[model samples]
Target: MRFNKELKNIKIYEAGKPIELVVREFGIDEKDIVKLASNENPYGTSPKVVEAVKLVVDKMSLYPDDSMFELKKGLSNKFKVKSENIIIGAGSDQILEFACRAVLNDNTKVLMNKITFAMYEIYALQQGAKVLKTRCYRHDLDEFYDIYKKASPDIVFICSPNNPTGDALGKEYIYTFLEKVKEPLVIVDGAYMEYAGYKDEKKRVEPKDLIDKFENVLYLGTFSKAYGLGGLRVGYGIANEEIIKNLYKLRPPFNITTLSLKAAVEALKDEDFVNDSVKRNFTQMERYVNFAIQRGFEYIDSYTNFITYIFPKEVSSKELSNRLLQRGIIVRDLTGYGMNALRITIGTKEQNDKFFEKFKEVLNGY
Candidate 1:
C-alpha cells in the first residue's frame, strides 16, 4: 500500500495523557492522578449543558441536525453576527482544515509564527501547501508582514494567546496588521480567547468586528476551552458569508454529534457559568505564577488557562516531567516543542496544591 508522501513527515499530535493511561502504567489509583496537561476547564461543563446532553443522549442513534440551526442561532446572538456567516465543525481544528482546503493548493504557501498551534502547518501540509514561519517564537506582525510581501502566502495564521507559550497579541495590533495584508485569508484561531478576554479586555478579539472589517479573515472559536465542553468537541468558524459558504462546501453532513450541538447551545445560554469559570481560572493561575517566581524560574505571562515555565540550562524539563508523572501528576513537557519548559493547565485549587507539592519534590531532586 502506498501512502501520500506528505503522510511520511506528518507528526501525529500527542494530546495530554489520560488519567486512565497513567493508572495502568504506574499503578497509581485513578483518583490520585492530577492532570494539568491539556488546557481544559478544571471545572467541567455547565450544569445546563450537562442537563441538555442528558435529554439528547437517547437520540444518539439519530443523526444530528445537519443544518445546525440552533447552535448557529445561539452563536449569532452571542457574537452579533448573521447565521449565514457561521459554519460548525467537529472542533475549531476541523474548521481550520476547511479553511486550509478552501484556499491552499500544491503551489500555495501559508505563513504563521514559528511556535503557534501545530495544527496550522499540519492541515496546510495535507493540502500539499508550503508552510512559512516567522523567525521569532511569539507572534511578530512586522516579521509576518515582511514575509507576506515576499512569499505572498495564500493563508496567514495568527494564534493569539498562542498555545504552549501563552502570550497573546492585542486586537488593535492585529487589526493594524490586517489592514496591511488584504489579499490572503488571515485565520485568527481564538481557541483560548475567553480566558484571554477575561484576563485583559484589550486581548479580546471580537469576531463580529474582525469579520466586518476584513472580508478575507476567518475567526475560529471553540467550546473546548473556557466553556468546559472539551469532551463534546464543539467548535465553529465565524467570517463573512462568502468565506463561510466556501467552507460549507467541504463540510460533511452531521459532522458534529447530536449531544455536542445541544451541549454547545446550552453552554452559550449560561454566560454566568463561562464567566465564573474564567474568573476561577485566573484566580488559581496566580498561584502557578507565584510558584515560578519564588523558585527563580522564568515563565510566560499567560493569557490562556495554562502557564509555561521555562527551566534553566542546568535543569532538565523532561526529567522533571517524568518525575511528576511517576508521582501521579500529568503536565505537558515542552521538549517535543524544542523548549526546555513545561506547560501546565491551571487546575482547581486542590489539584494545584497537589501539583505544587509534587513539583517541589521533583525540583528538589527528591
Candidate 2:
C-alpha cells in the first residue's frame, strides 16, 4: 500500500500535557497544577450548557443531526445570517481542514503570517499544498499585500488577535486587503474574537459582514473560547452561501455530536453568559498586562484571553516553561512558534494570581 508523501513530513501539534500527566511525571498532586495552557476558559461550561448536556446524555444511542439544523438555526439567529450561509463542524479546526480539502489541490499554495495558528500549515501539508509563510509578527498588512500581489495562493489564513502574539490587525487593514485581493479565498479565523474587546467600537469589524461584499471570504468562529465549550468540540463558519455549499461537500455525515448540538443550542441562547465571560476575561487580562508592565516584563498589549511575554534575555523559553511546570503551572512555550516567548492563558482571578506569583518567583531565581 502506498501512503501519501505529504503525510510523512507533517509535524503534529504538541498540545499541553494534561494535568494528570504532568502530575504523574513530576510527582505533584493534580490539585496543585494550575493549567494556564490551551487558552481554555477556567470557568468551565455555562450552567445552561451543563444542564442541556445532562438532558441529552440519555439519548447518546441516537445519531446527531448530520445537518446540525437546530444549531445552525440558533447561529443564524445570533449572527443574523441565513442558515444556509453557515457550516457547522466538530470544531473550527475541522472546518479549516474541510476548507483545505474542498479548495486546495497539489498545485495550490496556502498563505499565512509567520506566527499564525499551527493548524493552517498542518492542514495544508496534509492536503499536499505548498505553504508560503510571510514574515510578519502581527499580521503586517503591507507584507500581506506584497505577497498577495506577487503570488495568488488558493487560500489565505488570517487569525485576528493572532495566536502567540495576541495582537489584532486593524479593520482598515483587513478592508484594504479585501479590496486588493480578489482571487484567493480568505479565511478570517475569529476563534478568539469574543475576548478581543472591540465589539462595540467603530473600528470593530466582524468578518461575517464581508460575506456579501466578498465572495471568497470565510469567517470561522468557535463555541470553545467564550462559550466555555472547548470539550464539546463545536464551531462554525460563515461565508457566502455558494462557498458554504462547496465546503459542505467535504463534511461527513453526523460530523457534530448530539450532545454538542444540544449544548451549543442552549449556550447560544444564554447571551448573559457570553457577555460575562468576555467581561471577566478582559478584566483578568488587564490585570496580568498591568502586572507584567510594572514588573518590567516585555510583552505586547493583548486583545485576547492569553498574553505572550518574552522572558529575560538569559532565560530560554523552554527553561522558563520547565520551571513553571515544576511549580505546577502549565504555560505554553512558544519555541515551536519560532519565537523565544511564553504564552500564558488568562485563568480565573485566583488562578491568574497563583500563576503570577510563581512566574515572579521563577524570574527572581533566574
Candidate 3:
C-alpha cells in the first residue's frame, strides 16, 4: 500500500548522539565522554523527585494515574492557574502534536522563524499543513505582520529563546503584535524561558499573563530542561480552559508514566532545584559566550542552556563537530537547521573545560 504523500516530506528527527554511541565509536570509556548536546541538566534530578520516584517504583505493575490529577494540581499551584487549564504529555513535544492534531490540517498554515525548532515544521508537515517561515533569522514581529495577515495561518509558533539561535522576543513587542493579529492561535514554546531569566522570574513572561488578554494562545513547557528529567519525558501545556478542553480529547489516557508523573509533580513542588540548575547553567553559558567573543568567533548570545557558535570560514561546522567528537566531546551540528553553526550545551565547569581544551585544539590545528 502507498503511504500518504505527506510522509514523503516528513524527515526523521536527528537527536543528539547518546554517550553510549560516542564511547563505542571512538573506543573511549563511557566516563570519558562529555555530552554537551541535547541541553540536559548535567546535575542529577532533584532529591525530592528521587524520593518520589522510589515511592512509585513499587507500583510499576499498575497503570499510571491516567487523569494526571496530582500533577495538574501541582502545576496549577506553581503557575497560579486552574487545573483544567493544564494538559500533561509524555513530553512537551507530544503536547505540541496534540495541538497540531486538534487544529492544523491539509488546508491550513502555521508560522515560525527561519531557524526555529525543526519539530514545528515536522509536525505541521505530518498533518499536511503549510509552514510559513519568516524571511529573517529571527521572527521579528514587524517583519511577520504583513506576511502573516496575507497568509492567514491557522496557528503561529513563538519559540522564545529560539533553538539553534537563542535570541528571545521582548514582552512589549509581543503584546503590541498581539493587538494587531486577533485571529490565528499563537503557541509560545517556552522550553528554555526559565534559563533566559535563571535568577529573575520577572524577566520571563508567563503564558498565564497572556491567556486572559488573548483568547487564542497556548503555552508549551517541558520539565526536561530545568527539572533534570529528560529521561522521564514530562511536559505540559497551559492555555484558556475552552481551548484546553478541546485539546484534551486528543490526549491518550495514560500518556505520562507513573514515575514521570511522580517526578514532574515533585519537581514542580521543589522549584528551588530548578532554580539552582538554571542559575548554574547561566553562569556556565556566560563563560562560553565570553570565550567565543575573545576568540573572535561569531556566536549567538544564548538565553537557553546551550550556545550556538559559528566556526570561522576555514573550518565548517562539520569539521569542528568532528574534531570535538574525536576528543569525546559531543555537541550539536547545525547542518540540519541549515546553519553554519555548532551548538554546545552549557555543561558543568569541568565538562565545559573538557570541551574548551578540545575545541581550542581543533582551532589551533586548523
For 201-300, candidate 1 gives per-residue lDDT tens digits of 9999999999989999999999999999888888999999999999999999899999998999899999999999999999998998898889889999
TM-score of 1: 0.99
Model 2, stretches more than 4 Å misplaced?
198-203
Instruction: Supply the TM-score for candidate 3.
Output: 0.97
Off by over 4 Å in 3: 199-203
Model 2, span 1-366: residue lDDT tens: 999899999998998778987888899888888998888888887897898789889999999888788888988887788999999989999999999999888898989999889999999999899998887677887788788788888899989868878888777778888888889999998888876744434335575577867888999999988898888899999999888999898889988888988999999989788888778887888887798779777897777778898767677999989999999999999988888899999899999888988988998897
lDDT of each: 0.93, 0.86, 0.87
Of 2 and 3, the candidate ahead on TM-score is 3
Error of 2 at 80 (Å): 1.2
Deviation in Å, model 1, residue 316 alpha carbon: 1.2
Between which residue pairs do clashes occur in model 1? Answer: none
Task: Give all TM-scores, in the order shown.
Answer: 0.99, 0.97, 0.97
Q: Whole-model lDDT for model 2 versus the true structure? A: 0.86
Clashing pairs in 3: none
Error of 2 at 267 (Å): 0.6
Query: Quick one: ranking by TM-score, best first?
Result: 1, 3, 2
lDDT of the structure predicted as candidate 1 = 0.93
lDDT of 3 at 296: 88
